[model samples]
Target: MTTLDGQTALVTGAGRGLGRGIALALAAAGARVVLVSRTGAEIESAAQEIRSHGGEAVAVPCDVLDLARFEAVLDGVGPVDVLVNNAGTNAPMPFVAVSPDTFDTIFDLNVRSTYFLTQAVVARMIAAGTGGSVITVSSQMGQVGAADRSVYCAAKHAVEGMTKALAVELGPHGIRVNTIAPGYVETPLTAPYFADQEFRADTLRRIPLGRLGLVAEVAAAAVFLADPAAAFVTGSSLVIDGGYTAQ
Candidate 1:
C-alpha cells in the first residue's frame, strides 16, 4: 500500500500505453495527477478514466520537444511533487541506415525533452522547498545495444547519463532523479512488431522471464520510485526488464 497521499504528479505522454498506466497508478495511490501529451482528446479520456475510479487527474496537451511551450505547460499546472519524463520516440533502423533527421528526432524527444523538463520542474520544486522525485522512463536498450535500435539506444543512454548527473546536482536540493528501464513491454507502440510471431518469440526468449512485460508492471515500478517509500533512492536505474539484461 504505497501511497502518494497529498502529492501532485505530472506524467508526460499520458495519452496512452506506459504513460497512461503510470498516470492511473499514481492517481490510484492518491496522487493528484496531471496528464500531458500532444493528443488532447486522449489525455482527457485518460483523465476521465481516473475520475471514474475515484482518482483525481487533469489533462494538458503538450509536445515535450517544444522547449518554449514546456514551461508554459508546467505553469498551467502549478506546483508538482513528481515529474515523470516518459515522453520519448523510437526510430528503429540499422545503424548504417539511420539518417541525421532520424537521429535528431529521437534525441529531441527522448533526451532533450527529459533534460529541460526536469530543469523546469526542479526550479519549481526548489522554490517550494518540497523534496521531489523525477522519474525517466528509459529502455533496456540503454543498458544493452539491440539490432536496428541505434538511435533509441543512444537516446536512452543519454537519459541514463543525465539521470546520474542530475541526481548529484539536485540531491542537495532534496530532488531525486532516477530512471526505470523496461524491456519489451506489450503496448500499442510495440504492437505491430510483436504481431510478427518470429520477432515476438525471439523477444520473449531474450527475456529470461519467458514473457513480455505488462503496462501495469512498469506502472508499479514508476509508482514505487516516485513514492516516499523510495526516498533514499536516487541516481539509480530500477530495471524492469524481466531479466532481459541479466545475461
Candidate 2:
C-alpha cells in the first residue's frame, strides 16, 4: 500500500548524491527504479543495494550529455512513471573569467541534457496515456544569485523556466513538471567547497537553519512531488534552501 506502488521511476545521475538518495526513496515507496548515470560501477552498486533491500531497481549507465545515446538507453528501459533529471555539473568561475567553453559545458549537462531527456520521457508518457511526474534537481542559485556562480545560476534558471513552461503545456494531459531548488547540500560535488573554512562559514551563515541540507531532505521533496497527492501541483518549485532565500 505504498504511494508509488507499481509505478516505475527513472532517475538520472543516480550513481550518487541526491540522485541516489531520490532513487532509493522512490524504491522504498514501492516503485521499480531505473538508476542511470555515466559510471557503470556506481550505478550498478547503487542498484544492487536497492535490490538487497528488497526494492526493484536496474542500472543504466550512459552519459546524458549525449542525447542520442541517452534516448537509446531510455528506449531500452521502457516507459517510466517518474523522471528525475538530476545529472548536472558546475564550474565556479568569476564572471570576467567565464569562457564560452565553461558556459557550454555546464549548460550542456545541466540544462540541455535535462531538457532533451525530459522531452523523451514525456513523449513516452503521452503515448502511453499514463501521465507522469518530471522533477528537475535545480539549486538555490536558480532563485538567488551568488558570486562565482554565474554559469551555474544561469543554467539552473533555465531549468526552472523550462519546468514551468512544460507544466503549463502538459497539465491538460495530467502530467506534472516541477523543480526542486535545494541550498548547499552535502554531496561529492559540493564537498570541496565545504572543506574550506571560510566558504563553509559563509554558506552556513546564509542559511537560517544554520546547516547544510542533506541528500535525503531533497529526496523527500521528490517523493512528495511524485506522489498522487500532488496531482494538482504543477508549474512550481519546492525550495529546500534552509531559509537561505528568505533573506
Model 2 agreement with the true structure over 1-247: per-residue lDDT tens digits: 4799989999999999999999999998899999999899999999999999999999988988888887888789888999999999999889999999999999999999998999889998999998999999999899988899999999999999999999999998889999999998999988988999998999889889999999999999999999998988999999999999989
Worst 10 residues of 2 by lDDT: 70-79
TM-score for every candidate vs. truth? 0.98, 0.98
After TM-score superposition, the amount by which residue 103's alpha carbon in candidate 1 deviates from its true location, in angstroms, is 0.4
Cα lDDT, all candidates: 0.93, 0.92
Kindly list the per-residue Cα lDDT of model 1 for residues 120-207, writing each as its tens digit: 9999999999989999999999999888998898889999999999999999999999999999898999999999999998888888
Residue 152 miss distance in model 2 (angstroms): 0.8
